[model samples]
Target: MRDVQWIYSHEVVARPQSQQPTARIPAPTSAMQTCGPLLFAACRRRGRPSPADAVCRCLVIHLSARHDGTARRGGSVAATTKPSRLAASPTLPRVPIPTRTRSRMHLHQLKPGEAASLPRHLLEAHVVALVRRCCPGLLALRAAHARLIRLRLPRLTAAFALSKLLASSSSCGAAPSYARNLFDQIPEPTAFCYNSLIRALSSAAGAAPAADTVLVYRRMLRAGSPLPNTFTLAFALKACSIVPALGEGRQLHSQAFRRGLEPSPYVQTGLLNLYAKCEEVALARTVFDGMVGDKNYAAWSAMIGGYSRVGMVNEALGLFREMQAADVNPDEVTMVSVISACAKAGALDLGRWVHAFIDRKGITVDLELSTALIDMYAKCGLIERAKGVFDAMAERDTKAWSAMIVGLAIHGLVEDALKLFSRMLELKVRPNNVTFIGVLSACAHSGLVNEGRRYWSTMQELGIKPSMENYGCMVDLFCRSSLLDEAYSFVTGMAIPPNSVIWRTLLVASKNSNRFDIVQSASKKLLELEPCNPENYVLLSNLYASNSQWDRVSYMRKKMKENNVNVVAGCSSIEINGYLHKFVVSDDSHPEIKEIRLLLREIADRVVRAGHKPWTAAVLHDVGEEEKEVALCEHSERHGSWLPALTGNATTMSTVGVYSTARQIFR
Candidate 1:
């Protein structure tokens, strides 16, 4: 050091852009400055300054990239300089790492080939293990695991301790860390360690697992340990899937495959489960398609469920047929998926065929299967068949009752749904969130303001925390019932957080009930939530126009244009026979264009002769009175009617169905 020369920033006029110095540059100091420009130019001219530039650049790189633990944005090197309290201390290093732990952390703990190779999440999990142990139950388990990690400790003692902790309080916090001295002692894990963790994960199925699971996985991966059996993969896959760690799951899948675990039915199903949760449907299907023989019931069910959720009902039903042709048995899930496909496609005939198949198989109507059947029939216009299914059931769950209630509500049987709701409560099967949504919708449809209000209050009394959907239901319910003040108060005073759906529901409700005073505020919030949702923009403008706020209407319309929120053209469709014939409100695009025009004239003439006035307020257009009236009468449902007509379908009863709401109205 006495023979060596150290240059400070000011002493070095400049430095060349190069890599590290062979010797020390300068010690950390309170004040720091950049090298002079002249020195930089001179250093560039000679290889003499390469070492200095290297050392300087290396110091900056170290500070910016890793020294302070602030992960640098990729590709760009940044230097962070801050004052250290060590500058004033006599014995401490001038550069200090920010840390809060009272005990010293050995640097060798993060040495090469140590647990540092573990995934970042697992490393964080290890950090959590260091902090738990303030509670008595967890304290006991921590001591037991520590003892088990040591020599001469009976495995059963640790097992019993972990079991007692899980059984006593399902909500124990983080795990207790093993001792620092135990790092060098890589003893083989006994059977007890694996068994305890798995049992605890199974018992805590309702909740997510503690991060200890990840830590153990990391340790296993680092050691090239033998793979866990089918049950372990199944459980671990579920835990990983719940956290939605796509990368970790993919790694686990690779390990499973490497260990020849691919064909295991449970493992494959677990793979599908994980993929479906990740919304990687293609992967899930690929795994399902690779099954060697007739798949197990759970495997088939997982595939059907995956397709059903991804809106591929046709494929789901097709797979069901494929399974059936292979002599595989169909269960409630398969039946439910088939019925749901029928409802989505509006295939009433196919739905009836499924019902017959279910009967032939002697499949009894459980609550879920029965509920799906009821919904399929109701949606496909076979209300009578749906009611029959409801009546045939030996027993009903709250969902079954809600299904019927909702079907009746959709068909304008509000009183009927209410009666069934009362029956559900009397049966002592507690109603869930979906059940309340259905019943409240009934109140919305029937304009039962008092009944809807009472139900909203009763939800909290029943100890059910109202969700965002529940509040959306209440807002739309009040809005439909013309209880503007009540709907407004409910949304504004919600204890739980309000969501975009709640705001949008209030906005739409305002338009219907003519509550224009607060429409602007609701519309503003709606735009904030869904700035790119074109419907909200058009609907808000329509709301202003309906309430006679013509000036604000013009401003909103102009703003909507300025923001490029072009309204999608409103096309109406009617289902006639077996076809859907689409008709634009203003343009003629149907193959049956001539007939649609002629029918429109007939409907208009009949309207005038019958003395039924056209309510132009409901029309979502900025046209003149005559044009708006014509648009109102030529809705999509009117065109949909031509669909049935073209397909040789006929309506015996003169019922009118509104296109916008998707509900039929009997005249």
Candidate 2:
């Protein structure tokens, strides 16, 4: 037999088969031999001889000489052959095995059927390199895919590469359909492949794609060859959250429990987000409480955000405090949720404190967080602060611009809102439906009918199909301008069905205009749309009482009783010293109710002395004039207004609406 030299660990040994040690160094396998020339060519192309070049040259020479039968039988090839330069070089650098292996797997040199000769680990590495290089471009990815197919790699190897390609396609702005097609091409795909597709589609832009994410996840469940892992459950749960598939989310929650993946941080957070987003706060809390280990910020943020979404402001604030107690630093997301809750509660002082905390902690205020701050400040009656935050933002997206415009509009800063909108258009910041709502609202507030119409047309021209809120704003615009006929016409002519808010707007405006016919019609539509809304019943009853239709007013009351609809008492909240105090009409629940009542009486007496008269005509009850005045004095907003009097140092107070008597006193 011919003698051969084999690389054994760190050394090259040459010997004939008969004389070889029992513990022989095996000859270079077909993988190394096939890949050797490819590695050598790669080194040459770099125009530099690396340590890999020496290794590859030695491999090629030994393999070639052996196959060509250059060594005669029974002769010592070591004596006949010059020693390999690698063995002779006293200071030869060690070849980086991984580097050489990776270099040989380049897509250009990698051919069909040749990859099969490579070890499984090397083939996987090659597939990873192929994916990374080609994932960014669809055309390049398809080419790499074709090469992968031609090579006919093992199933697991191809699936791994294809799974990566599937995920990258979904995230790199490729259509979900492309990802679906790639997923279909995967033969007996593993849970990893299903997870990759599910994750990509879950975060897709629209509900339809998110639904597809759930579908892919279900397919994984049905296949059942490879059960869903922790990542699979996490991604699938996220899709359920986005689709708001509450039933599916619950099912996944159970699956997590059965699989014992409930303890996984990813799965637990996903469950929390799923329940929280679906408005199932109680269920979400159960899941949250079960997270016994070290909780991350995401878990806390998701829970707090759930409370904020449902307008459970107190709960959200309490959770935020708990998060702080846990020593978890609030990120921008946490702050956004907290600020949103404060806005809902009108907890101005608390909002300010949260803002200060953000600044003190040096948290990065991204666009979403900044927008939330603007909205919170605006709703808290701090328009100037909102404007400051808006101006301070280094970059503004559409939502940021819309938030500022909406804030100004609600605060009745019509000119500023309009000017800001104009600037937004000038800066090429495309206005969405929300932006038009603010524009139309500003016009409605100022009774600028022409400007409202102009902006409405501009919004349509920008291809922004009007949403329900946008249509509501336009209806309000016409109604506030005393164009009751136009408002009615606009509602009837809307492409989409007018919701209760639009009818309610028309009803209020018509009642204020004393157009009983319009009020009757609007109220009928509003009641039909939202039969349980006590405000609609009260408004209609008040309209009847104004016309001395006592029997009709009684009928309305009877209808409310029959429907079990109780009037929602007017409620207002004021924040002082970081505590939120709420007051309803004649509320006696406050711990300092006596002090508030005493201060209120004093303020009322002073306002009466100042020649202020309470407007009791709007009172719906058919009572004596003195009783109407008393009822007006006992209004919820009037009760809220006395908070500053009780707290002496309170600079700002917010109320739903105060009686004329209270308004003058508070101002």
- Each candidate: what lDDT? 0.62, 0.77
What are the runs in model 1 whose C-alpha is more than 4 Å off? 1-216, 222-224, 228-231, 240-265, 277-280, 290-294, 512-514, 544-639, 651-667
Whole-structure CA lDDT of model 1: 0.62
> Ten consecutive residues with minimal summed lDDT in candidate 2?
71-80
- In candidate 2, which residue pairs get closer than 3 Å at backbone N, Cα or C atoms, i.e. clash? none
